[model samples]
Target: VQDPKHAKKTARNQLHSGARLLVLGNNVMLYRHLLTLAQAKNHAIYIRDVVNVDKQDDGAAYRLFHSDVLEQMYQNELENNEMQSLFVYLFVLGDLFDSYLNRNIFHKERIIMAMRGYFFLNMWAEYIES
Candidate 1:
C-alpha cells in the first residue's frame, strides 16, 4: 500500500463497477478529544490537591487560591471542546506570552527570542490550518 501503484490498483479494483466513494475511516477526533479530556482531568486533580492539602503554610495556600490562572480556568467557557476550540485558546495564550516577551526580547535577545519564536510559531500554525 505504500507504493502509489499498488494503492492505485487497489482503489481501481474497488471502483470498477459502482463502488461508492466511501471513506474507510480516520481517527481525526481521537487526539483532540483526548487532549481536551486530559486538560479537564488535570484541572480537577489540581483542585482536589489544592483543597485537600493540610493548611500549614497559609501563605502558600493563599497564593494557590488566588492564582489568576485558576480564576480564569473557572470563569472561562470551554467551547464545544472541539479540536479547533482547544487550539484557539492555546494560541491566544501563546499570543499573550509572545506580546509580553516582545518588549523584553530585544534586551535579552537570545533567550527571549527563543521563547517568543515558540509562541509565534504555535499561533502561526494554528492560523494557517484554520
Candidate 2:
C-alpha cells in the first residue's frame, strides 16, 4: 500500500466514512496524506503534529514520561530487550538536561531534571550496558 494514489484513496475513503486515521510514514508521505485528507473536506480535519518535537527538548522528557510513549517503550524493551528503544527514552532525558543547562533555567527545575536523568540511568543501566 505504498502507492501514493492508493494511499490517498484509502485516506480519503476512511475520512469520508468517519474513521480515525493513523498514518505512519516519512515526512513527505505524511505531508501528502494530510494534504489529501484536508482536500477531501475543507476545515474539517484537526491535525495534531506530534511527529515534529525534536526542537522542544525541554518539555519532551516530561511529556514522554507522562504519556503512553514511555509505557510503550518499556513494553518494547521488555519484549525485545534490544536496548535501542530504551536508549531513545534515556537520550531524550539527556537532551532535556543539556537544554536546561544551556539555558538559564531555574535551579529547582534543573535539580528536578537532574534527578530524572539519574533515575532513568539507574533503572536502565543493565540494558544500556549490554
* lDDT of predicted model 1: 0.37
State how far residue 81 of model 1 sits from its true place (Å). 8.1
Candidate 2: misplaced stretches above 4 Å?
A: 1-91, 127-130
Candidate 1: the clashing residue pairs are none
Candidate 1 per-residue lDDT over residues 30-89, each given as its tens digit: 222322333563442233223334334333322322324343344442444334432333
TM-score of 1: 0.21
Q: In model 1, what is the error at residue 113, expressed in angstroms?
A: 11
Query: Which pairs of residues clash in candidate 2, taking residues 3 or more apart in a chain or in different chains?
Result: none
Q: Candidate 2 — worst ten consecutive residues by lDDT sum? A: 21-30
Candidate 2 Cα deviation (angstroms), residue 127: 5.0
